[model samples]
Target: MSDTLIDPPADGPTERPLPLRPALEAVLMVADQPLDSVALATAVGHPVEDVVAALQTLAEQYDEQDRGFELRHVAGGWRYYTREAYAPAVEKFVLEGQQARLTQAALETLAVVAYQQPVSRARVSAVRGVNVDGVMRTLLTRGLVEEAGQDVGTGAHLYRTTGYFLERIGVSSLDELPELAPYLPDMEDLEDELERVGGFQTRPDEQPGDQPGAATPTEETP
Candidate 1:
């Protein structure tokens, strides 16, 4: 029998595998959504159990170090979040007396959109108990939220938070959004009120694109 020689394909690029931890970190660092163990494992060519173990280890390491940030599981997946202890410093740096900031109403509307994205304008307005047409337009102009697609049932346009929104918030993904339940009114109650008030009946006549505005940082009301 003769020896067989294997030749590399000339037209294809070579593939290199990275070390498990660094590979996981690199992917998580830029991910705009919470990647599960299976997804991470597939991306890094590692076993799902190994990816899960690595994530747990990383979380523990960060906690032991008292780092300003933390690895957290939220919305059913894992991502990074600023440790509560460092929120003040982080906020000061991010806000920086920026004369322009989101208004309270806009902020509230944005939170609803961020949490319930791929949601229709009607649903958003319903949740907020107010017409969100203008606020949604503002969010779109600022590149914080975007048109996701049309809702199959109503044929209404759906919206979701943008990757830019995650970047601005210094979070890797939506899963990292701080828990709002403790601070805000009960969402179920709010939704019930919205329904009773018939909030979802009305919608913006103009589509998101028809709204006119320049993207600019907002100023807090005095």
Candidate 2:
């Protein structure tokens, strides 16, 4: 990041929030997945129209400056990705060894996305009792899951297993999957459980209350 990007203007109000574009950049820097305009608006305390404009300007500025990364809007949210031209370098650095298999957490996260999608990571986290952002990224990179769209009510980005997932799993379609939904707790009981307890399991990040840096879904994740 450029010093200019990180530093606020000397003339600007010291007590005021970071400017829209820079604030968006700050938030995007740490996000593990795309975040919708509504979520960004909520986080930055900006209107949706302003956030959209700021994102577009940032994207244009990066392209004009020939930066090494790009801002992309996928589904209903936006995220930063290394520019495509730099993919080879990233791949070389990141894929340092022979590819390893997914972790137990990733497998469990995948199962949730496979069966319960189009679902949100928050919900997947609720189901598996751990944050699924990292696992969801792994699945996305592995071509096992993809963004389906946002939830209509909450605007949370939803994910579903991809065609590649079915192919790898030797299933012709989702219809071939086991009937697990039927095994879930009754609807009211499940909501009560989720509301009462975060999930079946939890880590340092999970909690019963609204998740930090998470969109406040009208419904609970668990």
Candidate 3:
């Protein structure tokens, strides 16, 4: 989906060994984001078919009996990340104790993005009744949300949660979010409900079965 580090193949397949390994490593390294097979192939000057085979090989190598990291496809591209089992050690020392925390503003902005993903910043602001510029910046920095693309009408940047968001939220997919219906309030009772919650927040342990982010019924009227 994005530019990659592999070089385009020469005019023809020369006898020289394809730079498959280095090409993959280069694509994985210094990539601002993940590298998809098509992009990697384009970059490596090899056909996408060949690049894909090489990737499988690399992935299998990492999945061998012993390996510190694994190649994974996330956020629509491929990247090498440490295995989950080593997360604690990596977080405690290698990462200098940095852990992502969502601020109230970030959480609110994230809620809007999650519900109306591929949504423009303008739409998010309209729903939240507050400026979300700062919160959006934080989410981008934290790798929870990213610019999906530009809107068609005004060319406004669209936002969506990244794969990392699912991992952090302990959800495998967006469809896993709980369904909300019974918790929704009637039209006349909108303000009172939000007023009571102090701007709704879900408890961390709340499972997928719990109703969350159920805005008042009036908010549901298109």
Measured by TM-score, the strongest candidate is: 2
Model 2, position 137, has a per-residue lDDT of 65
Candidates' RMSD to native: 15.5, 10.8, 16.8
Clashing pairs in 3: 6-43, 6-44, 7-43, 7-44, 7-45, 8-45, 9-45
Residue range 170-209, candidate 2, lDDT tens digits: 9999999988877653323445434444432232322222
Candidate 3 residue-pair clash tally: 7
Which is superior by TM-score, 1 or 3?
1
Better of 2 and 3 by lDDT: 2
Q: Which residue ranges in model 2 land beyond 4 Å of their true spot?
A: 1-22, 31-67, 71-79, 91-98, 179-182, 186-188, 193-222
Per-residue lDDT over 1-222 for candidate 1, one digit per residue giving the tens place of the 0 to 100 score: 769987779878766767888888777765544667886788788888988999999999999999988888777677778899999997786556343687888788888888777776666665655566667766876778998877775566788999988998899988888887355444344555545545243333223222212221223321
Local error of candidate 2 at 113, Å? 1.9
Model 1 TM-score? 0.44
The superposed Cα distance between candidate 2 and the true structure at residue 145, in angstroms, equals: 1.0
lDDT of every predicted structure (CA atoms): 0.69, 0.70, 0.64
lDDT measured at residue 212 in model 2 versus the true structure, 0 to 100? 34
lDDT of 3 by residue, 1-222 (tens): 878788768776765545886777776754545778887877677878888888888889888855778888888778888888888887676344226456676777787788677775545654665545556656776678998877665455678999999998899998887664234333234444434433222222111111224332212210
